[model samples]
Structures are given as structure tokens and as C-alpha cells.
Target chain A: MKKINIKFWFVGLILVSFLSCSDNETETLFPDAPANRAAQRNAELLDLLLSQPNGFKGVYFTKNDEFGGFTYYLRFNADGTVDMTSDFDTETAVESSSYEVRLGTTTELVFTTRNHIQKVSDPSYQPLIGTGFKGTSVFQYFTNDNGTITLRDIRNRDSGTLVLTPANFSNFETESVASVETSLANRDAFINSTAVTAFPFLSVEAGGNLTEFALNYDGVRLFANPTKFNDDGSIADEEFGIAFTEDGLIISPALDVDGVLINEFTFDGSSGFEYVATKEGVTAKIGYGNAPVTPLDAYAFGVRATAGVFNMDERFKSSTAFNNFYDAFAEFLLNTYSVVVGNVVFWDLNNGGQPYIEFITNAGRFWWDLDFEVTNGIVVFTPTGNTNASAGVTAIFQPLLDAFIGAPSGYYLLNTGTYLNFSNRTYSMINVDDPTMTINYWDFSY
Target chain B: MKKYTYIVFAFMILAFAMACDDGSDAVGESQIDTTPPILNDLDVWLRGNFVSPYNIEILYKWDINDTDIDRFLHPPFESSVRPVAEALQKAWIEPYTQVGGENFIKKIAPRQFTLVGSFNFNPNSPTITLGLAEAGTKITLFNIDFLDFTNINDIKRPLKTVHHEYGHILNQNIPFDVTYGEINPADYTAQWFNRSDAEARELGYITAYGSSQAGEDFVEMVSEMLTNSKEDFDAIVESISDEESKGIIRQKEAMVVDYYKTNFGIDLYELQALTEAATQELVN
Candidate 1:
């Protein structure tokens, strides 16, 4: 989950405070109202409130006139957005709503979307609207504080207070999508660069041991010539050459020299040249005149350059190439368990506040350790223990831990203290002789 | 011939002696036997001792045969049927009387009835197969063979079923203020059989099979509510999807509240809380 900006709350508080004091006649009581009194007041209040990073990070409590009470955590961001999470009896439902606080004689806080407002009050309590009851009703602001706000109930007598307290923002953990994209791009680049060298090649050869030659062929020249003759008494000019025509040479019908057909030869930029007349070809030097560079080297360089650009483009364009890696990593952490076995104890660690499975032996007591990496939304656990252990240990703990970590929703690892009455039971350890056993239970009051 | 004559004479004399003995007993007895069992009037005696104010009508139907008894009732014994009868009496019938009062039961009487108990022998079927009120008569019991008097759970099952069916009877007699059309507009169909129980519960129906129609769902909810067993009902609620289930739960709750308020003049929520707490105790 993204961290909410603090400016939203700051602006809200400033508007609320200004509205609360606007009714006071302090300026009018003196003489002619000071020029720019309202503007000056606004600037000073804005500076004081906005200068300090404002955030509404707290648990809110409100009792509906009909539906009893509910608690929610409201997080106000600097971008004028609020994230509100309500933990109902069955599951936690979350909604995001934007608010615009209007400062006048009275603070007017208006929710931008009416649908976002959950009418906490029971419908029956309200007067019927046609066949059914009214869906929503609003309240006026009565008081405001750093961590709490009280709203004046127009429909009821007593003022309803909405208390806000700091909550563990880290609890709302979700995987970040950006990190996955970067890693995939890097992988593509490495593959493309290595593939250029092994690209398939083809070549040709000409006549005899004229070891070097230079001529202007296709606006370029080369000066290496090798000449040889076949056993058939036909001259085999095995040489590399640059062709002036786009369709260089046809190897089917042998090229005739003075109306006498010599032999057939294929051309490839690599392997220099070969004699077509010889059953087991002979090598010859062939060169293109004034050629900028070898065809093979030029093509290889171009391939490398294209590969580099392709990688760059992929890194920016394809989210799957990089983002998938992070997504998979997050998924893996959610599913696996870490088992740590010591000489005496074994520990199995998992995610989602589940109890750590602890096993004790003569050597020590092992427990499952849970650690959350909030920024990455990853939970890591290492199953470390005595290396020289029986296979039974792994077989016993691994599968059970795996099932717990992979269980679907509604399966939560709540603190045992929440449901189990610990005061009634006696705690004991197996290996340790000490009779005095201590257990630390968590209290999730907020 | 002489031996035959002697035998015939002896037979006649014996017959005459037996006749004389039968006639002499009435003349010999002088005392009027008035003594009852140590736990005299046991049915009334037991009812008086218990604090439960529910007047359970135990209808005895002797139509069940031995074969049907074996199939339906565990431990197919005449003596075993009593416990099941008693459990149904206490769990549902008695509780309804206590909550709704004797007048309520009277309005729906004949409070208790008995059948020949020979025609039907299966205890489970006798309890579930017969409709509570058919053609203006509420048939509480059919055959004793269909009930396992010893198993408290089995006894409670029919009792709950009857109560649920009775709720329907009452609702039909004196219409509830529930605007059923507004709650759900979709028509129930045979497609309901394909759905899981959770889906039915989420739709505010008691069982997935209840989605077959509005009437069946309503009856199921009533039955489930009266039985007050979380094991029987909580799973149905939990299995429901979040969005669709909430509406169903709320609707059921409202209907229950309205039923109690309009008819029984009792706080339904308070009663529900009590019933829920009791169910939890039984489960734990």
C-alpha cells in the first residue's frame, strides 16, 4: 500500500480551525477592521498548520443512533484523499473517500462521493422515505484535535465523538508493481548480446593462388587473392570477392571461362574461399575492393547494437518482463515456511501473525520466527537448525507449516490471547527443568 | 374303549374345575386397588418438577412396524422411543409453549394426539416425512418407530422441524409484515439444487436446496433459528460470499425481529442472543 500524503489533513485542520474561530467578533470589536485581516489570518494559520507535516493517522470511533457502534482507521493523505478501513465482525472492508473542508463561520466537511459514506445507523430508526427509509444523514463539526474529532449530531442530543489514534500503517501490506518491471528488462538485454556471436553464416570462393588482389567492385576494393587448380585440370580461383551485382553468383551451372565451363562455387563472407572443382575443396584468398569492413564483422556489430536497443525498449515497455519476477517472489514468500532446527529446539516461521510452531528437545527449544519486510511487502523466514538432524524433523514440520502459510482468507493467525483464556492454563516447557514458565501474550487494543 | 372313556371324563372334569376357579376370584376380592407407581402420574410429576414452562404435546402414533422401526430409530425398542419423545417435548414443543404461552398452543390445538403406531415403523421418516399441518390439521406425530427416543439430537430434529413448519402455519394464518417481494425479486427454481448450501444461506435462504423457492427458504430459516445450533447454521452463514451474504443475514435478522415483535410480543434480538449463547455452550 502507498503511504498517504500528510497535506490533506493539514489543510483539513486549517479549514476547521479557521471556521471555528470565524464567528468570534474580536476584529470587529476593536475599531475599523484591520485591512487584510482575513487574508493575514489565513496566511498565518496556513503557515503554522501546513508548515508542520499534517497527518490524520488514527483509529476512529462513532456510535450510530440506531446501529450501535463501529471502529475504523482513517488515514488522511496530503493529496486530499482519505483511506478508511473498517473492521466489521466478519471481515475487514476498506474504502477510500475524498473530503473537502470548507472554512466559514462553521466548518463544513463534505464527502465528495455520497456512496462512500456508510450509513452506520440502522434504516428503521430513520423516518420512512417512500417505501423504505432514508439512506444517509450528515453531521456538523463540533471539535477537532490532533488525534480526535467530535461531530455535532443534528438528529440527536449528545454529540458524537470520532476518536482517531495512530495505527500500524505497515499492517496494510501489498506488493509494489514497479519493482517487478526492472528485473525483467535486465534479463532480456543479457540474452540478446550473447546471441549475436552464434548467428548462422554463409560464404563463397573463386580461382587459384593469386594470394592478394585489389579492384573497385561495389564502390569498394580489397587486395587479397589466392589461386589454385583442381585435379581435373580446371583452374580453381578460390578467392573471396565483393560482387557488383546484388545477385552475386549462381552455383548451379558452372560459370564458363572462354565458353568452357570451369566449376561451381558458393559464396560466404566467412571461410575465405574454396575450389569448386576439387572434390575436397582447396582454400584461396578473395577480397572485395575498398570495402569498409568484413561483412561478418559489420553484421555482428549491427546485431549487438540492435540487441542493446531492444533491451532498453523492453525495459521501459514490458511490465511482465520485470514486474512478474517481483510478483512471483511475493507469491513465494506468502506460500513457504521457514524451519529452524537446533540441537534441542525446532522453529517454524510463517506470515500473517500465525503462531510459531515450537519443538523442544534436550538441546534447545525451537520456534517459528515471523518478520515482515514492509516496503517490499515480503515476509522472510529461515528454517535454520542443527545440520546433523534426522529426516523425520523435516518431514514432520515442513508440510504442516506449508499448509498454514497457504491457507486462504478467513484463516487468520490472531493472537491466541484474543480467543483463548490464558489465565486458566498452566504454561510449561518440556526440556528445561525450570518449573517457572512465562508466556507473553499480545494485546491488540487499538 | 374303557381308557378312552376315562380320558374324556378327566378332560371334562378339568374344564369344569377351571371354570369354577375363574368365577370364584371375583367373589374372593374385597379391596379396591388404588395404589399407583412410586413416581405416580409420572408424566405430570416430571413436568411439575422441571422449571421449564413449555407444555410439550407428545403425540403417540402406533402405526410403525418392526422393519420401519429398525430403519429409522436406533435401538428399535418401545422403551427407547420415550427419550426421543421427551427430548422433542422439551427442546422445541415445550420451549414454544413457554415463549408463546399456553394460549398460543391452545389456538393451534389439538395439543397432543396419538396414532395406531402400526402402519409406520421408520422413526426418521415418520418425523420428517409427515407435514405438520395438512388440510387444516396439524399432525404432530405419525409412528413411534420413526423416532430414536434415546438420541437427544435425533429427538430434537423433528421437534425443530415441527416448530419451523408451525411458524409458517402461523405466518400464513396471520400474515407477517415482511415485504418479501422487495427483499428478493428473483424466482426460485430447480437450479437451486446445483448450488451449495453456502450459496443458499448467502441469499438469505436456510439451505442451498432452499433456493428452490421462497416458501421452502422461509421454512428452513424458521427451523434453523428454533433449533439454535451454530453447527447447523453458522457454517451456512460463513460459507456465504461477503457482499451477497450480508443482505441475507440482515434480512433474516429483521424478519426474525418482526415475527417476535408482531406476534409473540417479545424482543427477537434478545432472544436470538440468548439462543446463540446457548448454542455456543452446547458446541463447546
Candidate 2:
């Protein structure tokens, strides 16, 4: 009986201790509840977004490698609506739309209605069919400093990073369109004019490293890629989205090279069209040169491998030596076979790693294969093979084909001075034997 | 004494365990948002035009939760919202009210309207979704950005959708005669897009999509009749060559008119005329 009573007392004491332990309070890191904390954070962000009296200069980056960035002037009102204008082609008209700051995985700033900002994300936008810029309107708040806020898009980590900084409202009101016009003019002066015979390249001197970059303008944005071509022959380039200010240009998200940054560039048109980026203690200059700033060997190979044809135009047949030969061939075909030639195309790298020049006619297409090589910044064609041509075609067209092939020195390929990119670019092929025999053909790939 | 000791231990343990809870924790405020949404000028206008009078809510804003997230959909442009909303009022709401009675639309109408800027393109199919209705409570309009008020065709597309979806809403309240589906039961197929609109009409249906199912066929008749002027409708009936198919179509048309009169207390012809006039007013 004494043992039983002792056992009961032991169990009773154990139960009492367990109940007391259950009542013990556990300490929490946050003084407030998680829900309350989230609500508070959302409210703070909403207040901060609405607090900008002068409005915000919003920079939105596209996730895709081909496209880079866009700029917008946004004014957030207390009514959960935002008035927005963008730097996209004569779109200075302000559009008002709704927005909301809500707490999800993180606090988010969502553009609830379609506005100028949504144009970049619109899937039906023609340039980026099925994928419109690959951008997002829902941005998660990342950081907030003095007057600037950084947000990451919620769709994908690399979808975009929207950075908002305070802007002078009055200045944006009057000078927005002026700045766009100036940017267009400056772009034309730099690389897109007929008189621009030289290729304009950028030299960035930062952190004791001087890197020469090839410049590519996609009409809407500008990109500077390092001249180093990869083993696969693709140019690994970094795109910088820039917005033109009244004085110069502002590069959004900044260009960082080896831990050194360059953000703004002032236009210098005294000597030639040059943009000097001296901001962030870095000196970068855009200078012009007759020869390409990048290596020539890989570019020529890539162009031939991808696009095998340089279609000839009337200008190529305008020379006396070429004109007589071309006309005689056409007249012969007309008189003999009643066939009319539509186009004469030179395929530097046709099927089987051979070269062929094709004559597309109303009757049928004819090809005469040739031996070719790319050396000394030019492509030389030797009239050796006529495997693709019929016996009758070879007998009648071989002599004309040989004359059209020009001298053994071949043709010197020069940029037409409008664009340097492979797509939508024009290159003038001047005969090595006769300099007067020059013809320009557009890529038309775009 | 031993039994008394056991009982006392049990009582003591029960007392200790019972004392553990004091019920001091109070219920917190609900995390659900209850505050009224902030209204801008457009929102205010929508409230006055749609909500105050008819109890309908127009959601022009892009809320991913309100749509199918898988489909790449966007909100209608702010500039396009009012034009589309006004057209809906004139063509759909006003005409229905005038014919169906003053309080007709208020009692029997979609409560919510969701406006989307981009067309809802299906990933695997060539067909694009123009509009969708959910349980007769909500109607989602797509491709609002392409609405050209100056073009009568553009005005007809959305108005036809409203009338089509509204037809379903009426049927939900009071269904069409079940015998109506029996008129041409053999023609319905999921692959209705394979047939042309002309072929579907020859098979006693109004449109290619109308031949998909009986419910769609009924709504198609309502939508096509209301959107098409009487002259166009008569011309279509006249064009059909098959006597049996034409008779079936005529039988369905009488049922549609009778459905409206008996169920909703509205003359289908009068409502059709009003809607046509309202649509013409937009282009003029």
C-alpha cells in the first residue's frame, strides 16, 4: 500500500510538471504577429511609392538577351492609380491606370491596369511575337534608399529589375519629347547615316583595363559587346538601356566593368559624333574608324555559314563591263529559250561547303558552282566548277559567269555605313580588278 | 486509506492540468481586407454608370486571380475601358432594359464584367477565346484594345458576346425547351471548327461554334438574331436550300422568340431592333 501511494504521488508530480511546462511562454523574434508585420510592411511601401512629389523615373529591363531596357516617367497617386509616360516613339502622352501594393511571398507593387508600362509585356507586340520583351508588371519590393527604390519582377528572377528614382517633374513635362528627338538625332549621327563611312566603336577605360567594344543599335536600344568572339562564334554582349537627358544620356542599371561603373555619357560633336562617359570616375569614348574594331575572320565565317547569298541589284549590273555581259546573257536566254532572269545571287557558301551563283528566271532556276575563299578582308571566287548547271546552260552561260566572277583578287567587302550588324545591314562589294565596279546589297534578314 | 490516497492523487493531477489554460488569448482582427478599394475617376464613373443603377461591377484592372493564369492575358487599356463600357451600356444594357422592362437587366444580368486587352490565344489550337462566362455571374471580354468604335464590325463582336452570354444567363434562370436540342441532335460535335459557318447553317445551326453543343446552339441563335438586323437574318434563312434544315431552323427560331416572351417577358424582335439601332448609333 505504501509503494502504491508513492507511485501515485510520483505520477501526480509528473503530471503537474508537464502541465506547468505547457504554460511556459516561448519567445518570438517579432513583437507583432506575422500577419500584422506583413500588413505594416505593405503599408510602408505603398506610402513610400505615393510620397514622391516630383514623380519617379522608372527603368524597366527586359529579361531576353536580344532586348535590354525601357524608361518611364511614373506618378503614383493616393487613389491607387498611376500616371505613366514612356520613351517609346512619340508616346509622351500620359496614361492613367490602377496599381496596388499587396503582400504575397514578398510585398509586391502590381500595375493593375494596362498602360504604357504594359506595352513591353504585351505578348501581341509584333517584334517579340509569342514573347513580348519577356517582362513583367508585378514587381517585388527589394530595397529602398534616400529616394530610390529597387524592385524585382515576380514572374522570373531575370524577368526584370525595375529601379525607380526621383525625377524633376517640371523638366520631364517640357523636355521629354525633346530628349527623345535629341536621342534619335544623336543615334543617326553616330552610326546610322549614309555619310558615316567608318564603324563607330566604344572604348571603355575602367579599373586599369581598356576594353574595346563593338556597338550594335536595335533602333529602340543600344548595346556594347566585347569584341571577343566565343568558340561557337556568338558574341557575348552586355546590353545597356539608356535614356537621353537634356544634356546627355543616362544608362540605366549602370554599366559595370571589372567593379568600375559608367552611368552617363555627354555627346561631343566637335571633332566627330562622339559620346564621352566620364561619370562614375570612368572614361569611355565612342570613336570612328575605317576598319572594324572587332576581329574580322569569325564575323565573315558566321555570315557565310548563316546567310549564304548576297543578292545582286541593278547597281551591280550598272558598270559597262558587267552591263554588256549581263544584258547579252539575258538577251541570249530571251532569244533562245524565252526565259527572263529575275535575280542573280552569289552564294559564297552553298550546300556541300561549295559556292554557287544562281540565276532565277521565269522558266527555271540555274546554278553554276565555283571555288571560293575568305582572306585579306575579302572573298575571292575562282570560276572552277559548273556541276549544278546543265550541259546546255554551261555551254551558253559559262562565259558570262566567268566575266561576272571578276579577277582572281575578288571583291573587297565594306560596310555600307548604315549598320554593322549582320541583320538588316548593307555591305558594298567592290571589284578588286576594277574599283569602279561596286555594288551594295541589303541583308534583309530582319 | 490507500484508495483514498489514489483518488486524491488523481484529483490533484486533474486540477493541475485543468489550471494550465486561462483563456487569456483574444481573437485577433481578421486578416481579410475589409477597407473599400480606392477609386479613381474611371472607377467613379463606372460606379455611377454601372453599379449605382444596375449593380454590375466592371473590372478593367488586370487581376491574375480573376483570370486563367496559364493564358497570357492583360488588362484593357485605360483609354479603351470607357469606350467599351459605354458601348456595352448602349447596345446591351439600354436596349435590354427598354424591351425587357425597366428593372429587367437589373434582375437578370451578369454581375461582373472583366475586360482584357489581349486576345486569349489557346496554346495548342488555332481558335482564340473571345469571351467566357462563369456560372452566369461573370462575363470576361477579350481583345478590348482592338475595339474601333468607328467600325460597325467591332461594335458587333462585343455586343454579340454580351447577348450570347446573357442568353445563357436567362436559360440558367429558366431553361429553353429541352425538345429544342432534339431538333438536330445528330449534328453536334466537339470538332465543330472543322465545319464552315455555311455548312453549320445548312445543318440547322447558326454558326460553326453553335454546332458544338446544344447549349451553345441555343445561345448562338439568340446572339445571331439580336446582333444581325432582321433583313440579314431573313436573307440567311432565305439562302438555306435544304428544306428539312430550314424547317428545323425556323422551328428553333419560333422557340427562341417564345422562350424570351414566356420566360423573360421581353419581345425578342423588339429587343433586337433596339440593339441594332443602338449599335448603329455608335458608328454614326
| Leading candidate by TM-score | 2
Candidate 2: clashing pairs of residues:
none
Q: Quick one: RMSD of model 1?
A: 44.5
Best by lDDT: 2
The C-alpha local distance difference test score for the whole of candidate 2 amounts to 0.73
Candidate 1 ranges with C-alpha deviation above 4 Å:
A1-446, B1-57, B63-77, B108-110, B113-131, B135-137, B141-156, B185-187, B190-196, B229-235, B273-284
lDDT tens digits by residue: candidate 2, A1-446? 97987988788798757867574677778987777788888988888888876578776775534455666778888877788777654656777788999876799998988887887767677755545665666788988988689888776555468888887567655554454455545544444443343345667776677766666445443444435455687776656555554456655456776677877678776765567887555688755544456754323522533233343443431333345456677898899889787776665553355566777778778887677676876777776665666888767766656555655677667655333333454565556655445445554321
TM-score of the second chain for every model: 0.58, 0.88
lDDT of 2 at A48: 86
Q: Provide the lDDT at A374 for model 1.
A: 13
How displaced is residue B203 in candidate 2, in Å? 6.5
Q: Is model 1 an incorrect, acceptable, medium or high docking prediction?
A: incorrect
Candidate 1 lDDT at A135 equals 18
